[model samples]
Target: MAERLHDPWLVAVWPGMGTVAMGAGYYLMAKLGMHLWEELPARDLFEVDHVDVKDGLIQTAPLPRSRLFLWKDPNEKHDLIVFIGEAQPPAKSAQICHQLIDLVRPLGVTRVFTFAAMATGLRPGEHGRVFGAAIDRGTLDRFRDLDLTVLEGGQINGLNGVLLGVAAESGMQGGCLLGEMPQLFSQLPYPKASLAVLEFFATLAGIKIDLTELESHAQDVEDKLETFLSRIEQAIHQVEGAGESAIPALDADEEDEKKKPKLSAEDRQHLEQLFTEAKADRARAYFLKQELDRLKVFRDFEDRFLDLFKK
Candidate 1:
Protein backbone atom coordinates (compact mmCIF):
# COMPACT_ATOMS: atom_id res chain seq x y z
CA MET A 1 0.00 0.00 0.00
CA ALA A 2 1.08 3.56 -0.67
CA GLU A 3 2.13 5.72 2.27
CA ARG A 4 -0.41 8.02 3.86
CA LEU A 5 0.04 11.77 4.40
CA HIS A 6 -1.60 14.28 6.71
CA ASP A 7 -4.11 15.90 4.37
CA PRO A 8 -1.50 16.75 1.76
CA TRP A 9 -1.68 19.07 -1.23
CA LEU A 10 0.00 17.92 -4.48
CA VAL A 11 1.80 20.64 -6.43
CA ALA A 12 3.28 19.86 -9.85
CA VAL A 13 5.74 22.20 -11.53
CA TRP A 14 7.03 21.70 -15.06
CA PRO A 15 9.20 23.54 -17.63
CA GLY A 16 7.49 25.99 -19.93
CA MET A 17 8.07 29.40 -21.49
CA GLY A 18 10.82 31.41 -19.68
CA THR A 19 11.43 28.46 -17.25
CA VAL A 20 10.12 30.87 -14.60
CA ALA A 21 7.43 28.56 -13.25
CA MET A 22 9.65 25.53 -12.71
CA GLY A 23 12.57 27.59 -11.39
CA ALA A 24 10.32 29.17 -8.76
CA GLY A 25 9.16 25.73 -7.66
CA TYR A 26 12.75 24.57 -7.25
CA TYR A 27 13.59 27.68 -5.24
CA LEU A 28 10.69 27.04 -2.90
CA MET A 29 11.74 23.44 -2.33
CA ALA A 30 15.23 24.49 -1.30
CA LYS A 31 14.11 27.44 0.83
CA LEU A 32 11.56 25.36 2.74
CA GLY A 33 13.99 22.47 3.32
CA MET A 34 11.80 19.89 1.61
CA HIS A 35 13.05 16.31 1.57
CA LEU A 36 13.19 13.79 -1.24
CA TRP A 37 10.56 11.14 -0.58
CA GLU A 38 9.96 9.23 -3.88
CA GLU A 39 10.83 9.20 -7.57
CA LEU A 40 9.01 8.30 -10.75
CA PRO A 41 11.01 5.57 -12.43
CA ALA A 42 12.32 6.90 -15.78
CA ARG A 43 13.11 3.63 -17.58
CA ASP A 44 10.18 3.95 -19.96
CA LEU A 45 9.12 7.59 -19.56
CA PHE A 46 12.26 9.15 -21.09
CA GLU A 47 14.94 8.39 -23.66
CA VAL A 48 18.41 7.26 -22.56
CA ASP A 49 20.80 8.86 -24.99
CA HIS A 50 23.17 10.70 -22.64
CA VAL A 51 26.71 9.30 -22.45
CA ASP A 52 29.38 9.76 -19.78
CA VAL A 53 33.08 10.10 -20.65
CA LYS A 54 35.58 9.30 -17.89
CA ASP A 55 39.33 9.08 -18.63
CA GLY A 56 38.78 8.40 -22.37
CA LEU A 57 36.37 5.56 -21.62
CA ILE A 58 32.83 6.07 -22.99
CA GLN A 59 29.83 4.85 -21.02
CA THR A 60 26.11 5.41 -21.42
CA ALA A 61 24.14 6.69 -18.46
CA PRO A 62 20.51 7.38 -17.68
CA LEU A 63 19.35 10.96 -17.93
CA PRO A 64 18.01 13.03 -15.03
CA ARG A 65 14.95 11.49 -13.41
CA SER A 66 11.74 13.15 -12.25
CA ARG A 67 11.26 13.29 -8.49
CA LEU A 68 8.76 14.11 -5.75
CA PHE A 69 9.68 16.04 -2.60
CA LEU A 70 7.76 16.26 0.64
CA TRP A 71 7.50 19.02 3.22
CA LYS A 72 5.56 17.87 6.29
CA ASP A 73 5.11 20.68 8.78
CA PRO A 74 3.30 19.12 11.73
CA ASN A 75 2.49 22.55 13.15
CA GLU A 76 1.00 23.74 9.88
CA LYS A 77 -2.50 22.98 8.56
CA HIS A 78 -1.30 21.09 5.45
CA ASP A 79 1.56 19.00 4.08
CA LEU A 80 3.00 19.59 0.59
CA ILE A 81 3.94 17.03 -2.09
CA VAL A 82 5.94 18.60 -4.91
CA PHE A 83 6.53 16.76 -8.20
CA ILE A 84 9.52 18.11 -10.11
CA GLY A 85 9.91 16.66 -13.58
CA GLU A 86 13.28 16.58 -15.30
CA ALA A 87 11.71 15.49 -18.54
CA GLN A 88 8.05 15.17 -19.43
CA PRO A 89 6.68 11.71 -20.05
CA PRO A 90 7.55 10.62 -23.59
CA ALA A 91 4.60 8.33 -24.39
CA LYS A 92 1.35 7.28 -22.78
CA SER A 93 1.33 10.47 -20.69
CA ALA A 94 -2.33 10.12 -19.78
CA GLN A 95 -1.56 6.74 -18.28
CA ILE A 96 1.36 8.28 -16.44
CA CYS A 97 -0.88 10.98 -14.98
CA HIS A 98 -3.41 8.36 -13.92
CA GLN A 99 -0.68 6.34 -12.21
CA LEU A 100 0.44 9.47 -10.33
CA ILE A 101 -3.10 10.17 -9.17
CA ASP A 102 -3.45 6.61 -7.92
CA LEU A 103 -0.11 6.80 -6.07
CA VAL A 104 -1.14 9.99 -4.23
CA ARG A 105 -4.68 8.78 -3.53
CA PRO A 106 -3.58 7.02 -0.37
CA LEU A 107 -2.02 10.29 0.85
CA GLY A 108 -5.45 12.00 0.98
CA VAL A 109 -4.52 14.48 -1.74
CA THR A 110 -7.66 15.88 -3.39
CA ARG A 111 -6.43 19.31 -4.37
CA VAL A 112 -3.79 19.93 -7.07
CA PHE A 113 -2.01 23.09 -8.19
CA THR A 114 0.33 23.60 -11.14
CA PHE A 115 2.68 26.45 -12.05
CA ALA A 116 3.28 27.94 -15.53
CA ALA A 117 3.83 31.23 -17.41
CA MET A 118 1.79 33.29 -19.85
CA ALA A 119 3.62 35.25 -22.58
CA THR A 120 2.28 38.77 -22.90
CA GLY A 121 3.96 41.35 -25.18
CA LEU A 122 4.47 43.90 -22.41
CA ARG A 123 7.74 45.58 -21.34
CA PRO A 124 9.76 44.96 -18.18
CA GLY A 125 8.26 47.88 -16.28
CA GLU A 126 4.87 46.15 -16.62
CA HIS A 127 5.96 42.88 -15.03
CA GLY A 128 4.39 41.12 -11.97
CA ARG A 129 0.80 40.35 -12.95
CA VAL A 130 -0.26 36.80 -12.13
CA PHE A 131 -3.17 34.98 -13.78
CA GLY A 132 -5.12 31.92 -12.68
CA ALA A 133 -7.51 29.34 -14.11
CA ALA A 134 -9.45 26.42 -12.66
CA ILE A 135 -12.05 23.84 -13.55
CA ASP A 136 -14.53 25.11 -10.95
CA ARG A 137 -16.04 28.47 -10.14
CA GLY A 138 -15.22 28.28 -6.44
CA THR A 139 -11.48 28.11 -7.12
CA LEU A 140 -11.71 30.94 -9.65
CA ASP A 141 -13.57 33.08 -7.11
CA ARG A 142 -10.89 32.42 -4.53
CA PHE A 143 -8.17 33.76 -6.86
CA ARG A 144 -10.30 36.75 -7.83
CA ASP A 145 -10.73 37.65 -4.19
CA LEU A 146 -6.96 37.69 -3.89
CA ASP A 147 -6.83 40.24 -6.74
CA LEU A 148 -5.21 37.82 -9.22
CA THR A 149 -6.33 37.94 -12.83
CA VAL A 150 -8.65 34.98 -13.54
CA LEU A 151 -8.51 33.72 -17.11
CA GLU A 152 -12.03 33.48 -18.45
CA GLY A 153 -11.81 31.53 -21.72
CA GLY A 154 -8.30 30.69 -22.91
CA GLN A 155 -7.01 27.09 -22.80
CA ILE A 156 -3.94 25.91 -20.84
CA ASN A 157 -1.66 23.36 -22.48
CA GLY A 158 1.09 20.88 -21.41
CA LEU A 159 1.43 18.59 -18.38
CA ASN A 160 0.40 21.36 -16.02
CA GLY A 161 -2.80 21.80 -17.99
CA VAL A 162 -3.55 18.09 -18.29
CA LEU A 163 -3.55 17.59 -14.51
CA LEU A 164 -6.76 19.56 -14.34
CA GLY A 165 -8.49 17.16 -16.73
CA VAL A 166 -7.28 14.26 -14.59
CA ALA A 167 -8.54 16.01 -11.46
CA ALA A 168 -12.01 16.28 -12.95
CA GLU A 169 -12.14 12.50 -13.31
CA SER A 170 -12.18 12.10 -9.51
CA GLY A 171 -14.22 15.20 -8.58
CA MET A 172 -11.07 16.80 -7.13
CA GLN A 173 -10.41 20.49 -7.73
CA GLY A 174 -7.28 21.86 -9.42
CA GLY A 175 -5.92 25.30 -10.30
CA CYS A 176 -2.99 26.70 -12.28
CA LEU A 177 -1.25 29.98 -11.50
CA LEU A 178 0.52 31.40 -14.59
CA GLY A 179 2.83 34.37 -14.15
CA GLU A 180 2.98 36.92 -16.93
CA MET A 181 6.27 37.09 -18.88
CA PRO A 182 7.09 39.60 -21.57
CA GLN A 183 7.45 38.07 -25.04
CA LEU A 184 10.97 39.49 -25.28
CA PHE A 185 12.07 37.50 -22.21
CA SER A 186 10.36 34.30 -23.27
CA GLN A 187 13.73 32.71 -24.04
CA LEU A 188 15.14 33.31 -20.54
CA PRO A 189 14.14 32.74 -16.94
CA TYR A 190 12.19 35.73 -15.61
CA PRO A 191 12.73 35.80 -11.86
CA LYS A 192 10.56 38.86 -11.32
CA ALA A 193 7.65 37.03 -12.92
CA SER A 194 8.40 33.97 -10.84
CA LEU A 195 8.47 36.11 -7.70
CA ALA A 196 4.97 37.31 -8.45
CA VAL A 197 3.68 33.75 -8.80
CA LEU A 198 5.44 32.63 -5.65
CA GLU A 199 3.88 35.46 -3.67
CA PHE A 200 0.43 34.43 -4.81
CA PHE A 201 1.19 30.78 -4.13
CA ALA A 202 2.19 31.60 -0.56
CA THR A 203 -1.12 33.34 -0.08
CA LEU A 204 -3.18 30.56 -1.66
CA ALA A 205 -1.48 27.73 0.26
CA GLY A 206 -1.25 29.64 3.53
CA ILE A 207 2.51 29.28 3.69
CA LYS A 208 5.32 31.71 4.55
CA ILE A 209 8.42 32.05 2.36
CA ASP A 210 11.29 34.58 2.50
CA LEU A 211 11.84 35.94 -1.03
CA THR A 212 14.83 38.16 -0.26
CA GLU A 213 17.33 36.04 -2.20
CA LEU A 214 15.21 35.74 -5.35
CA GLU A 215 14.50 39.49 -5.25
CA SER A 216 18.23 40.33 -5.22
CA HIS A 217 18.97 37.94 -8.11
CA ALA A 218 16.14 39.44 -10.18
CA GLN A 219 17.45 42.99 -9.70
CA ASP A 220 20.93 41.98 -10.85
CA VAL A 221 19.59 40.40 -14.03
CA GLU A 222 17.49 43.48 -14.82
CA ASP A 223 20.49 45.78 -14.48
CA LYS A 224 22.64 43.66 -16.82
CA LEU A 225 19.84 43.49 -19.40
CA GLU A 226 19.44 47.26 -19.41
CA THR A 227 23.19 47.71 -20.01
CA PHE A 228 23.12 45.24 -22.92
CA LEU A 229 20.21 47.05 -24.56
CA SER A 230 21.97 50.41 -24.28
CA ARG A 231 25.02 48.98 -26.06
CA ILE A 232 22.88 47.61 -28.89
CA GLU A 233 21.11 50.94 -29.36
CA GLN A 234 24.46 52.71 -29.59
CA ALA A 235 25.69 50.25 -32.20
CA ILE A 236 22.54 50.79 -34.27
CA HIS A 237 23.00 54.58 -34.24
CA GLN A 238 26.65 54.27 -35.38
CA VAL A 239 25.66 52.05 -38.31
CA GLU A 240 22.77 54.25 -39.38
CA GLY A 241 24.93 57.44 -39.33
CA ALA A 242 27.89 55.90 -41.22
CA GLY A 243 28.96 57.64 -44.49
CA GLU A 244 26.40 60.45 -43.94
CA SER A 245 27.16 64.16 -43.81
CA ALA A 246 25.02 65.44 -40.91
CA ILE A 247 23.58 68.99 -40.60
CA PRO A 248 23.79 69.94 -36.87
CA ALA A 249 20.38 71.66 -36.51
CA LEU A 250 18.60 68.95 -38.53
CA ASP A 251 20.20 66.19 -36.37
CA ALA A 252 19.10 67.97 -33.16
CA ASP A 253 15.48 68.22 -34.38
CA GLU A 254 15.49 64.54 -35.42
CA GLU A 255 16.77 63.47 -31.97
CA ASP A 256 14.09 65.51 -30.27
CA GLU A 257 11.35 63.88 -32.34
CA LYS A 258 12.71 60.40 -31.58
CA LYS A 259 12.54 60.91 -27.80
CA LYS A 260 9.46 59.69 -25.94
CA PRO A 261 8.09 60.93 -22.60
CA LYS A 262 9.23 58.88 -19.65
CA LEU A 263 6.48 58.03 -17.21
CA SER A 264 7.04 58.69 -13.51
CA ALA A 265 6.55 55.98 -10.91
CA GLU A 266 2.98 57.08 -10.17
CA ASP A 267 2.18 57.47 -13.87
CA ARG A 268 3.61 54.03 -14.72
CA GLN A 269 1.48 52.45 -12.02
CA HIS A 270 -1.60 54.19 -13.38
CA LEU A 271 -0.81 53.00 -16.92
CA GLU A 272 -0.42 49.42 -15.74
CA GLN A 273 -3.70 49.61 -13.87
CA LEU A 274 -5.46 50.81 -17.01
CA PHE A 275 -3.81 48.05 -19.08
CA THR A 276 -5.03 45.38 -16.69
CA GLU A 277 -8.62 46.64 -16.89
CA ALA A 278 -8.45 46.74 -20.70
CA LYS A 279 -7.11 43.18 -20.83
CA ALA A 280 -10.00 42.00 -18.64
CA ASP A 281 -12.49 43.69 -20.94
CA ARG A 282 -11.04 41.93 -23.98
CA ALA A 283 -11.11 38.60 -22.15
CA ARG A 284 -14.80 39.03 -21.44
CA ALA A 285 -15.52 39.61 -25.11
CA TYR A 286 -13.49 36.52 -25.99
CA PHE A 287 -15.49 34.49 -23.48
CA LEU A 288 -18.73 35.51 -25.16
CA LYS A 289 -17.35 34.71 -28.62
CA GLN A 290 -16.34 31.23 -27.49
CA GLU A 291 -19.85 30.59 -26.20
CA LEU A 292 -21.30 31.39 -29.60
CA ASP A 293 -18.89 28.93 -31.29
CA ARG A 294 -19.55 26.13 -28.81
CA LEU A 295 -21.24 24.10 -31.51
CA LYS A 296 -18.49 24.62 -34.11
CA VAL A 297 -15.99 21.80 -34.17
CA PHE A 298 -12.75 20.99 -35.98
CA ARG A 299 -10.68 17.81 -36.07
CA ASP A 300 -6.98 17.06 -36.57
CA PHE A 301 -5.78 13.49 -36.96
CA GLU A 302 -2.16 14.24 -36.05
CA ASP A 303 -0.26 11.52 -34.22
CA ARG A 304 1.84 13.95 -32.17
CA PHE A 305 0.96 13.20 -28.55
CA LEU A 306 2.91 16.16 -27.19
CA ASP A 307 0.58 18.42 -29.13
CA LEU A 308 -2.26 17.58 -26.76
CA PHE A 309 -0.80 19.76 -23.99
CA LYS A 310 0.26 22.47 -26.49
CA LYS A 311 -3.41 23.45 -27.10
Candidate 2:
Protein backbone atom coordinates (compact mmCIF):
# COMPACT_ATOMS: atom_id res chain seq x y z
CA MET A 1 0.00 0.00 0.00
CA ALA A 2 1.29 3.49 -0.84
CA GLU A 3 1.30 6.06 1.92
CA ARG A 4 -0.60 9.17 1.02
CA LEU A 5 1.84 11.98 0.39
CA HIS A 6 1.28 15.75 0.30
CA ASP A 7 2.20 17.33 -3.03
CA PRO A 8 5.45 15.37 -3.27
CA TRP A 9 8.48 16.22 -5.35
CA LEU A 10 10.89 13.55 -6.51
CA VAL A 11 14.69 13.69 -6.39
CA ALA A 12 16.51 10.83 -8.05
CA VAL A 13 20.21 10.02 -7.75
CA TRP A 14 22.77 7.51 -8.95
CA PRO A 15 26.48 6.91 -8.50
CA GLY A 16 28.57 9.15 -10.72
CA MET A 17 31.79 11.11 -10.97
CA GLY A 18 33.22 12.17 -7.58
CA THR A 19 30.24 10.41 -5.96
CA VAL A 20 28.56 13.80 -5.94
CA ALA A 21 24.98 12.71 -6.70
CA MET A 22 24.93 9.65 -4.47
CA GLY A 23 26.60 11.47 -1.59
CA ALA A 24 24.05 14.27 -1.64
CA GLY A 25 21.15 11.83 -1.93
CA TYR A 26 22.33 9.75 1.04
CA TYR A 27 22.93 12.84 3.13
CA LEU A 28 19.45 14.15 2.36
CA MET A 29 17.88 10.83 3.27
CA ALA A 30 19.83 10.66 6.52
CA LYS A 31 19.19 14.25 7.59
CA LEU A 32 15.52 14.17 6.67
CA GLY A 33 15.00 10.92 8.60
CA MET A 34 13.28 9.46 5.56
CA HIS A 35 12.12 5.87 5.58
CA LEU A 36 12.37 3.38 2.76
CA TRP A 37 9.16 3.61 0.76
CA GLU A 38 9.57 1.07 -2.01
CA GLU A 39 12.14 -0.63 -4.18
CA LEU A 40 11.64 -0.44 -7.92
CA PRO A 41 11.78 -3.91 -9.47
CA ALA A 42 14.66 -3.84 -11.97
CA ARG A 43 15.96 -7.37 -12.28
CA ASP A 44 15.48 -7.35 -16.03
CA LEU A 45 17.24 -4.02 -16.44
CA PHE A 46 20.45 -4.86 -14.58
CA GLU A 47 22.79 -7.83 -14.82
CA VAL A 48 25.45 -9.24 -12.51
CA ASP A 49 28.69 -8.75 -14.37
CA HIS A 50 30.99 -10.07 -11.69
CA VAL A 51 31.20 -11.90 -8.36
CA ASP A 52 33.11 -10.93 -5.25
CA VAL A 53 36.03 -12.93 -3.89
CA LYS A 54 36.73 -12.64 -0.19
CA ASP A 55 39.32 -14.70 1.66
CA GLY A 56 39.84 -16.89 -1.40
CA LEU A 57 36.12 -17.74 -1.73
CA ILE A 58 33.85 -16.53 -4.51
CA GLN A 59 30.65 -14.90 -3.24
CA THR A 60 27.60 -14.22 -5.30
CA ALA A 61 26.85 -10.52 -5.46
CA PRO A 62 23.32 -9.28 -5.57
CA LEU A 63 21.98 -7.19 -8.45
CA PRO A 64 21.89 -3.45 -8.00
CA ARG A 65 18.73 -2.03 -6.40
CA SER A 66 16.65 1.07 -6.96
CA ARG A 67 14.83 2.35 -3.90
CA LEU A 68 12.55 5.25 -3.03
CA PHE A 69 12.35 6.97 0.35
CA LEU A 70 9.70 9.36 1.60
CA TRP A 71 9.87 12.37 3.92
CA LYS A 72 6.79 14.26 4.96
CA ASP A 73 7.05 17.96 5.47
CA PRO A 74 6.27 19.27 8.93
CA ASN A 75 4.95 22.56 7.54
CA GLU A 76 2.89 20.74 4.84
CA LYS A 77 4.37 22.82 2.03
CA HIS A 78 5.33 19.68 0.13
CA ASP A 79 6.59 16.14 0.70
CA LEU A 80 9.90 14.79 -0.59
CA ILE A 81 10.73 11.49 -2.24
CA VAL A 82 14.34 10.50 -2.78
CA PHE A 83 15.15 7.73 -5.20
CA ILE A 84 18.58 6.14 -4.83
CA GLY A 85 19.73 3.68 -7.42
CA GLU A 86 22.63 1.43 -6.44
CA ALA A 87 23.80 1.48 -10.05
CA GLN A 88 22.50 2.67 -13.39
CA PRO A 89 21.24 0.09 -15.84
CA PRO A 90 23.62 -0.68 -18.68
CA ALA A 91 20.79 -0.10 -21.15
CA LYS A 92 17.15 0.95 -21.33
CA SER A 93 17.56 3.61 -18.67
CA ALA A 94 14.69 5.60 -20.15
CA GLN A 95 12.38 2.60 -19.71
CA ILE A 96 13.22 2.22 -16.02
CA CYS A 97 12.76 5.94 -15.51
CA HIS A 98 9.30 5.64 -16.95
CA GLN A 99 8.56 2.90 -14.44
CA LEU A 100 9.90 5.08 -11.63
CA ILE A 101 7.71 8.00 -12.61
CA ASP A 102 4.70 5.73 -12.96
CA LEU A 103 5.14 4.58 -9.38
CA VAL A 104 5.56 8.07 -7.91
CA ARG A 105 3.10 9.94 -10.08
CA PRO A 106 0.11 8.25 -8.47
CA LEU A 107 1.35 9.56 -5.10
CA GLY A 108 1.02 13.21 -6.24
CA VAL A 109 4.59 13.73 -7.37
CA THR A 110 4.64 16.40 -10.09
CA ARG A 111 8.21 17.64 -9.98
CA VAL A 112 11.44 15.67 -10.30
CA PHE A 113 15.06 16.69 -9.74
CA THR A 114 18.31 14.87 -10.36
CA PHE A 115 21.80 15.55 -9.10
CA ALA A 116 25.09 15.07 -10.97
CA ALA A 117 28.70 16.22 -11.18
CA MET A 118 30.25 18.41 -13.85
CA ALA A 119 33.96 18.03 -14.39
CA THR A 120 35.82 21.29 -14.88
CA GLY A 121 39.31 22.72 -14.63
CA LEU A 122 38.48 24.30 -11.28
CA ARG A 123 40.99 23.69 -8.52
CA PRO A 124 40.05 21.88 -5.34
CA GLY A 125 40.41 25.03 -3.28
CA GLU A 126 37.80 26.78 -5.42
CA HIS A 127 34.12 26.57 -4.62
CA GLY A 128 32.11 24.21 -6.80
CA ARG A 129 29.55 26.17 -8.79
CA VAL A 130 26.08 24.68 -9.14
CA PHE A 131 24.96 24.29 -12.76
CA GLY A 132 21.35 23.65 -13.70
CA ALA A 133 19.20 22.57 -16.64
CA ALA A 134 15.42 22.61 -16.48
CA ILE A 135 12.78 20.91 -18.57
CA ASP A 136 10.51 23.94 -18.85
CA ARG A 137 10.60 27.72 -18.93
CA GLY A 138 9.19 28.13 -15.43
CA THR A 139 11.73 25.78 -13.91
CA LEU A 140 14.52 27.42 -15.85
CA ASP A 141 13.39 30.74 -14.50
CA ARG A 142 13.44 29.27 -11.00
CA PHE A 143 17.00 28.12 -11.53
CA ARG A 144 17.98 31.58 -12.71
CA ASP A 145 16.34 33.08 -9.64
CA LEU A 146 18.50 30.81 -7.51
CA ASP A 147 21.59 32.29 -9.25
CA LEU A 148 22.67 28.94 -10.65
CA THR A 149 24.75 28.81 -13.84
CA VAL A 150 22.46 27.48 -16.50
CA LEU A 151 23.93 24.68 -18.54
CA GLU A 152 23.74 26.07 -22.06
CA GLY A 153 25.04 22.96 -23.77
CA GLY A 154 26.81 19.63 -23.40
CA GLN A 155 25.57 16.27 -22.11
CA ILE A 156 24.85 14.97 -18.63
CA ASN A 157 25.84 11.35 -18.95
CA GLY A 158 23.94 8.49 -17.25
CA LEU A 159 20.61 8.27 -15.48
CA ASN A 160 20.97 11.53 -13.60
CA GLY A 161 20.18 13.39 -16.81
CA VAL A 162 18.16 10.71 -18.57
CA LEU A 163 15.62 10.47 -15.75
CA LEU A 164 14.78 14.14 -16.08
CA GLY A 165 14.19 13.75 -19.80
CA VAL A 166 11.72 10.99 -19.09
CA ALA A 167 9.99 13.17 -16.52
CA ALA A 168 9.62 15.97 -19.04
CA GLU A 169 8.14 13.55 -21.54
CA SER A 170 5.58 12.61 -18.87
CA GLY A 171 4.56 16.31 -18.68
CA MET A 172 6.16 16.76 -15.27
CA GLN A 173 8.31 19.74 -14.35
CA GLY A 174 11.90 19.00 -13.31
CA GLY A 175 15.53 20.03 -13.52
CA CYS A 176 19.03 18.74 -12.92
CA LEU A 177 21.61 20.27 -10.60
CA LEU A 178 25.21 19.56 -11.50
CA GLY A 179 28.00 20.42 -9.08
CA GLU A 180 31.34 21.34 -10.52
CA MET A 181 34.31 19.09 -9.69
CA PRO A 182 37.98 19.10 -10.59
CA GLN A 183 38.46 17.03 -13.68
CA LEU A 184 41.85 15.79 -12.52
CA PHE A 185 40.21 14.29 -9.44
CA SER A 186 37.15 12.92 -11.19
CA GLN A 187 37.84 9.46 -9.75
CA LEU A 188 37.96 10.81 -6.19
CA PRO A 189 35.00 11.65 -3.96
CA TYR A 190 34.52 15.42 -3.70
CA PRO A 191 32.21 16.25 -0.84
CA LYS A 192 32.46 19.95 -1.68
CA ALA A 193 30.52 19.35 -4.85
CA SER A 194 27.88 17.43 -2.94
CA LEU A 195 27.59 20.23 -0.42
CA ALA A 196 27.10 22.81 -3.16
CA VAL A 197 24.32 20.84 -4.84
CA LEU A 198 22.50 20.25 -1.55
CA GLU A 199 22.83 23.86 -0.49
CA PHE A 200 21.20 25.06 -3.66
CA PHE A 201 18.49 22.41 -3.55
CA ALA A 202 17.66 23.08 0.09
CA THR A 203 17.22 26.77 -0.58
CA LEU A 204 15.16 26.20 -3.71
CA ALA A 205 12.91 23.69 -1.96
CA GLY A 206 12.43 25.95 1.07
CA ILE A 207 13.73 23.22 3.37
CA LYS A 208 15.98 23.58 6.37
CA ILE A 209 18.59 20.93 7.07
CA ASP A 210 21.79 21.27 9.05
CA LEU A 211 24.72 21.51 6.65
CA THR A 212 27.43 22.06 9.24
CA GLU A 213 28.74 18.50 9.07
CA LEU A 214 28.84 18.48 5.29
CA GLU A 215 30.47 21.88 5.27
CA SER A 216 33.22 20.70 7.60
CA HIS A 217 33.79 17.54 5.55
CA ALA A 218 33.98 19.56 2.35
CA GLN A 219 36.60 21.86 3.80
CA ASP A 220 38.63 18.90 5.02
CA VAL A 221 38.61 17.27 1.60
CA GLU A 222 39.36 20.53 -0.20
CA ASP A 223 42.39 21.12 2.01
CA LYS A 224 43.69 17.59 1.44
CA LEU A 225 43.19 17.74 -2.33
CA GLU A 226 44.72 21.20 -2.49
CA THR A 227 47.79 20.03 -0.63
CA PHE A 228 48.07 16.97 -2.87
CA LEU A 229 47.80 19.16 -5.95
CA SER A 230 50.48 21.46 -4.62
CA ARG A 231 52.83 18.52 -4.19
CA ILE A 232 52.20 17.46 -7.79
CA GLU A 233 52.79 20.99 -8.97
CA GLN A 234 56.08 21.11 -7.10
CA ALA A 235 57.11 17.78 -8.60
CA ILE A 236 56.26 19.05 -12.06
CA HIS A 237 58.25 22.26 -11.53
CA GLN A 238 61.30 20.26 -10.39
CA VAL A 239 61.07 18.01 -13.40
CA GLU A 240 60.70 20.95 -15.76
CA GLY A 241 63.67 22.74 -14.20
CA ALA A 242 65.83 19.71 -14.98
CA GLY A 243 67.24 19.48 -18.53
CA GLU A 244 65.74 16.88 -20.88
CA SER A 245 68.74 14.52 -20.48
CA ALA A 246 68.58 14.84 -16.68
CA ILE A 247 65.34 12.81 -16.63
CA PRO A 248 65.17 9.17 -17.67
CA ALA A 249 63.15 8.34 -20.79
CA LEU A 250 60.43 5.81 -20.03
CA ASP A 251 57.41 4.36 -21.80
CA ALA A 252 53.96 5.75 -21.02
CA ASP A 253 52.97 2.67 -18.97
CA GLU A 254 56.16 2.79 -16.92
CA GLU A 255 55.79 6.52 -16.36
CA ASP A 256 52.24 6.05 -15.15
CA GLU A 257 53.30 3.26 -12.76
CA LYS A 258 56.19 5.38 -11.48
CA LYS A 259 53.86 8.30 -10.79
CA LYS A 260 51.59 6.20 -8.58
CA PRO A 261 52.41 6.13 -4.90
CA LYS A 262 52.97 2.76 -3.20
CA LEU A 263 50.88 2.21 -0.08
CA SER A 264 52.77 1.02 2.99
CA ALA A 265 51.57 -1.62 5.44
CA GLU A 266 50.89 1.06 8.06
CA ASP A 267 48.81 2.98 5.54
CA ARG A 268 46.79 -0.18 4.85
CA GLN A 269 46.14 -0.62 8.58
CA HIS A 270 45.03 2.97 8.90
CA LEU A 271 42.69 2.53 5.92
CA GLU A 272 41.13 -0.53 7.57
CA GLN A 273 40.53 1.45 10.75
CA LEU A 274 38.99 4.30 8.77
CA PHE A 275 36.76 1.86 6.90
CA THR A 276 35.57 0.45 10.24
CA GLU A 277 34.75 3.94 11.48
CA ALA A 278 32.95 4.75 8.23
CA LYS A 279 30.86 1.57 8.52
CA ALA A 280 29.72 2.75 11.94
CA ASP A 281 28.99 6.29 10.70
CA ARG A 282 28.37 6.73 7.02
CA ALA A 283 29.29 10.43 7.14
CA ARG A 284 32.86 9.30 7.71
CA ALA A 285 32.77 7.28 4.49
CA TYR A 286 33.94 10.25 2.44
CA PHE A 287 36.97 10.54 4.68
CA LEU A 288 37.74 6.88 4.06
CA LYS A 289 37.26 7.48 0.34
CA GLN A 290 39.67 10.40 0.45
CA GLU A 291 42.32 8.24 2.09
CA LEU A 292 41.79 5.48 -0.43
CA ASP A 293 42.10 8.00 -3.26
CA ARG A 294 45.25 9.52 -1.80
CA LEU A 295 46.78 6.07 -1.74
CA LYS A 296 45.44 5.41 -5.26
CA VAL A 297 43.62 2.28 -4.06
CA PHE A 298 40.05 3.56 -4.30
CA ARG A 299 39.37 1.26 -7.24
CA ASP A 300 40.38 -1.72 -5.11
CA PHE A 301 37.88 -0.76 -2.38
CA GLU A 302 35.24 0.94 -4.54
CA ASP A 303 32.52 -1.72 -4.12
CA ARG A 304 32.93 -2.09 -0.37
CA PHE A 305 33.27 1.65 -0.02
CA LEU A 306 30.01 2.29 -1.87
CA ASP A 307 28.30 -0.42 0.19
CA LEU A 308 28.63 1.86 3.22
CA PHE A 309 25.61 3.82 1.99
CA LYS A 310 23.50 0.85 0.90
CA LYS A 311 20.91 1.15 3.63
Best by TM-score: 2
Quote the lDDT for 74 in model 2: 94
Per-residue lDDT of candidate 1, residues 264-298 (tens digit): 67754744454344234422222221221121210
In candidate 2, what are the lDDT values of residues 1-311, reduced to their tens digit? Answer: 44577789999999899989988987787667576778877676787789998899999877887888778999888799999888898898888888999988888889999999999999988777999999889999999988999999988788888888889988999899999999988987788999999999999999997787788878987887787788767666778776555544432322343377668889989998998997777656656755675576766676676565554
TM-scores of all candidate predictions against the true structure: 0.71, 0.79
Lowest-lDDT window of 10 residues in candidate 2? Answer: 249-258
lDDT of each: 0.67, 0.83
Clashes (N, CA, C under 3 Å) per candidate: 1, 0
- TM-score of model 1 (CA atoms): 0.71
- lDDT for residue 44 in candidate 1, whole number 0-100: 51
True-vs-predicted CA distance for residue 292, candidate 1, Å: 51
